[model samples]
Target: MTMTRRYVQDLQDGETIEEVFLLVDKQLRANRNADLYLLATMRDKTGIINGLMWNVSEESMAQISAGDHVQIKGKVQLYQGSLQVIVTRITKVASDNLDPEDFQPTSSQNVSELLEQLKSRLLGIDDPQLRSLMECFLIDEDLMDSFSRAPAGVKAHHAYQGGLLEHVVRLMEMAWRIGDLYPEVDTNLLLAGVFLHDLGKVREMAFEGAFTYTDEGQLIGHLVIGVEMINEKVAEVEKLTNEPFPVETALRLKHLVLSHHGQYDYGSPKLPMTPEAIALHHLDNFDAKVHEFARSIEDDPNTDSHWTPFSPRLDRKLFKGAN
Candidate 1:
């Protein structure tokens, strides 16, 4: 495979660099004098960087859009201890010349192995009905392929390819380890909830290029979509068994999907009402938050300081503890 000329992670302050990047975001903004400037967010598999081009007309970037491969000439500068580029010139390039793998962030874990682990846990559920429901999803080759490649989110926690699989499998492991402590918690129900909670993300996120939401994802959202998916699979499972799926069991499973977000402000249509639902909500939140914190520390550009700059998303600075 042909190598990338330069990656965002390799950029250094005060360096004059020329490279091609995936233009993941762009904005035409007005400056202090009301003059127009173009702000761009560029990316590669390694990371992303922002660039500013001064004195540019809106028409200058009229044809450029996010997801287009672009070539840029710029001088790297450290702004507030983070690197950004003072772009001299930028223009879109033909993707025919570039490899898509060089621009998309993929998970470090082996996706197939992660999928296998997920299967082993869900398939082990002793509840006959729950196991049958899981089998309906597991046997769908296309769904499993997308699930293995979908991101947990566009830019938060586990956002790379295969991230959904990685995040779900970790939640399963954590749920399994805590089983002894929460003896009253139904392990079968909790495990099924964990597996199904974020399953809608496979359709919600588009990872073929830049990670973005789909039309169904934007209009309907994942919580509702997840419940819809479960209902469809429940119908199939019933057909296979020639018996009705337990109504209460299906209701509890749907509750886990809808309430996993924990609160109305977070987009959950319903609050976690059951012990299993409550447990899934907290465990999902814990894993996502911890991953975000660790990524902030690892991706912080200020190597000279022990603390990362204030993150607007996190609402606080993270300490790296004296380099």
Candidate 2:
């Protein structure tokens, strides 16, 4: 029988069940206490649940590593108005028993729906060469599947499956709105840059169950990959015409991707120097930072002027509104 999911707050004196979860982070407890303990985040389709492995032993660690799929047997407990799992036993699921799709966190946006949205956005770009390059890959069934399934970032922001597309769509929306405000930012160029900025992320992440950076990603990172992607696509499209993709235009778009991080200290090789690049940088950061605050509010509800820790992605502190 499929395991019945019981939230950590739903336990009676002795209720038990098996659960699958993405272990966000893990480490050995400093003191070697009698009963080993593990803190992990458990989730199904609904949302995440705070879990605890109260009876963790060396045997448990031997079979499962962080980011592995496991069937944990535990009873739920409520503490300080929060729900937590008190694990009595755990079974590391074999690769044969586990399905990668079931364990990966996905977006609520239906795959078909999001794909349609992406196609529509692609059609909206006005540059002839940019549109052709976009059409080249967006029409491929296999590449489309991978792009939609990829996570936007390994962890920082838009970390859920299909998050890459979601983040791009959001950036596109912001770019369109910014276009309304400036009217001189060259909407076509800005739109093209926004869609392609994270396109290379599809190659950057290696998703077995939980998404993580591939060797290529760790070595060169997404910015460099994106610049390379633009160059290749430009070359492929240039074959159709005797003239090559305009050097200036390609440089402008590549510069935006490389500098979206905003500063040398923050992974950007150069700061956003162009008007379009500066706008993309701030809007992208705004969307990511806003979502970080949203996650913090969901996880920790006690909002009475607590000092939110520094958000590495936003490079700022998240402040919660008080009750």
Candidate 3:
């Protein structure tokens, strides 16, 4: 029998649902009585919902993995003011029957339009050497495709298809305005830094179905990988010009990528030491933190309250005022 599918956003409380969902996360837990249960996060393009499988057997738990599309039978209910599914049955759907497009979320903005905005901003750089460096990245069709599709992170911020492009374009726009206010900042270097800061994420994440860190991402992280990418591109620029790229200019650009995180503990090996690096760090942080807070408010399931539940990341509740 073919069951009617309900997207996560459309599910209502007290409804019995039989649908196919992407298994975004799954884990085994013990109940108070020492019985094992399955805890999972089921998702579709619209959103994700928590799920619980009571009295789950080891054999049943072994049948599925995160990122698999599965047929699920469940009842939707409210738990702690949040929607959760009490799953009764789950079976993995065969790969041939699955269409991954239904599971990946995408940005509201147009991808091509966003890419064009980024290109136009990069082209405005007056420094010939810096513009050449930027050109090397934009000219690569493969890298641009990856950039357009890559997510800014697995979950923290801009974690959707085309999210990387959205985040970068927003950051560039903000950096441009801030550079005007502070003329001391090197606009070319600052803009270039904003463009390159998260470029490594294209390789660091696997976004074909679900967002997850690649093996290299876990081992080395994006900052170091990005620095390596800059070096390779700088070498190419030098070969094309038949002369070495300026040492100070290359060092400054690399510093922005390496130090955008702001502190040693925050993941930066070196702290922001230049005007452009400092501006890049703050601008990047402002964009990411604002998005995180806004997303938290939107994702909050408590429709009856003015405040969202405490976010462990933000360490406080957010006010969702009608005003």
- lDDT-wise, the better of 1 and 2 is 1
Model 2 Cα lDDT, one tens digit per residue, 1-323: 15554433344443556666655445445345555677766544334565667555665567666666667777766455345677766666665755555556777678777778768877878788778877866766776788888878766677778888888888887788778789868778787888777777887888656566788999998899999988877787788665677889989989989999898988999899898888888888888877767865555423444645555545666666554
lDDT of 3 by residue, 86-107 (tens): 9999888886866676788899
What TM-score does each of the candidates earn?
0.95, 0.78, 0.93
TM-score of 2: 0.78
Which candidate gets the maximum lDDT versus the true structure? 1
- How should the candidates be ordered by TM-score, best one leading? 1, 3, 2
For candidate 1, the per-residue lDDT at 54 reads 96
Model 2, position 75, has a per-residue lDDT of 77
Give the per-residue Cα lDDT of candidate 3 at 136.
90
Give the candidate number with the greatest TM-score.
Answer: 1
Q: State the C-alpha lDDT per candidate.
A: 0.90, 0.71, 0.89
RMSD of each: 1.9, 4.5, 2.0
Model 3 residue 306 lDDT score: 93
Which regions of candidate 2 are displaced past 4 Å? 1-3, 7-18, 23-43, 46-60, 73-88, 95-102, 301-323
